[model samples]
Structures are given as structure tokens and as C-alpha cells.
Target: MAPGVGGAITGAAAGKFFSWLLESERARPPRVFVSFDFDNDQQLKHLLIGQTKRQNLPFSVVDGSLKEAAPEPRWKEAALKEIRRCDVVVVLVGRYTYKAPGVLAEIAMARSEGKPVVQLIGSRSLGYTRVKGAGKVLAWTQDNLTKLFGND
Candidate 1:
């Protein structure tokens, strides 16, 4: 075989190998617990969630859009349970997040459970306040999402 042909075959084989590796990494979508101030940040949270779904990102939000109809104590219990099941927690930090007791509690629970926490600050106007146990605090963007969840 010609040397150029041999080099081409080798390059094709390497490309195929890397492609397979990337696919394998994407196969197991991580379970994510998203903690946000539902009352104040719902729209932004929904937008992020929608983008993830539309883009077929490599992660699943364990907490669906279900409202917490239960009382505060029971709701916290349920939220903690969901957080425990997830591999990571994404906290949507907005201006009202510090004032939202439930959001703070969720972040605390995630920390107690040893789940990795990724904080997504919705706006610069909100002023960034790092969550107690956040592993990363980043602006809301697809590139930041990729940083947390890996390239899709």
C-alpha cells in the first residue's frame, strides 16, 4: 500500500475511536437536582431546562415541574430525598435566592449529602453570592452548562 494511503487509514481509525469514546461518555446522562427560587426564578429556570431538553444535553433534571403541595417540613424532606438520588445539584441563584429559605435549605441538603453543587447566577445585577458549598459559580450560558455537564 502507498504510504499516504496507510496514513489515511490510520487517521480514519483514530477518528472512529475518538468518536466512539465521546458517544460512550454521552450515553449515561447524569441525574441532576436543580434548586431554584421557584417563585422568583421560575421563568429563567424553565428556560434553562427547556434549552437542555431541546439540545438533548447529557443530564436529567430529577425534580420535574411538580409543585410542592405538601407543607414545608414534608416538602423539605422530599426535596432532600431527590437531591440524594442525584449525582449533582445545580442551584439557580438569582436576586431572591438568598432570601428564599427553601433554596438555601436545598443547597444545605446537597452539601450534607456530598453532592457536587454547580451554581448558575442568573444575572450580574443580582450580585453574585456564592452558595455555601458550591463547587462552581458561573453565569448562565450554554458554555457554562457544558462546563458542568460536559459537551453534548
Candidate 2:
């Protein structure tokens, strides 16, 4: 092989290898599937999502869209699929969250999929109901959220 051609090929290979290594090293934020009371706390869910955009939190909320899934069976299936895709599940606890059937089902699905569940207190007011089997709720905060998702 010509000396110039050999050097050029080796340099190109090294550059490609370096790029690949960097790409693997750069870990994207965790994919979070947020489960919230759909009927009574849609606004709370929106607010949480808004924080993700504005604060640039260390997690991306996966749009499971289980609420729109047709029929009860399909909804469960969709929930399971979405939960499987996410690295963790974040349940937004509201005043009526404990009674929400959809939220309850989603939480169960998340558990079945073996995803880590992080419950956040959605309402600041007292007397908010916490969902059962969803673990204890933590006060929502940027640092808290960052740490939760950063655990990976």
C-alpha cells in the first residue's frame, strides 16, 4: 500500500472510532413514563410537563397516551407497552389520585414491567390523597427530580 493512502485510511478509521466512543459515552436523560390522575389532575400533569420544557430537567416524559387507548383491555395493553419503553415511572399524586382507576391500573402495569416508580406530590395544599401501591410521595423539586432520574 502507498504510504499516503495507508496513513489516510488509518486516520479516517481512528476518527470514526472516536466518534462512536463519544456517542456511547454521552448518555441521554432517562425516559420517564408519568402516571397521573387523568380526570381530576390533568392540569397538574400539564404543569409537570411544562417544567420539563422550561427547566430542562434530566428526564424526558414519555407520551404513553394510555388515556386515549380504546376500550379497557387495549388501555391496559397500551399502558404496559409504554411502561416497558420507559426507564422509570413517575406518578403525580393529586387530591383525588388515590381514587383514579386509570392511575391505579397504570401503576400496576408499571410495577409488572419492573420499572422504578417515583411518586411526586402534585398538590401543595393539604389533604391531597396519595395513591395506594404507588409508594410514598416526595415533594416535587428540580434537584430531587434530577437526582431521581440521574440514578439510572
Best by TM-score: 2
User: TM-score for every candidate vs. truth?
Assistant: 0.73, 0.77
Q: List model 1 lDDT by residue over 22-121, tens digit each.
A: 8886677778888888788887678777888799676777764347456787888788889878888988888777667787888888889988888888
Backbone clashes in model 2, listed as residue pairs: none
Residue 130, candidate 1: Cα error in Å is: 3.2
**lDDT of model 1 at residue 3?**
70
Spell out the clash pairs found in candidate 1.
none
lDDT of 2 by residue, 36-104 (tens): 877777887788889999986777988786554478898778888889989889899888888888888
> Once superposed on the true structure, which residue ranges of model 1 sit more than 4 Å away at CA?
1-27, 64-69, 125-128
Candidate closest to the true structure, highest lDDT: 2
Among all windows of 10 consecutive residues in model 2, the one with the lowest summed lDDT is 63-72
Root-mean-square deviation of Cα positions for candidate 2 versus the true structure, in angstroms:
5.8
| Global fold similarity of model 1 (TM-score) | 0.73
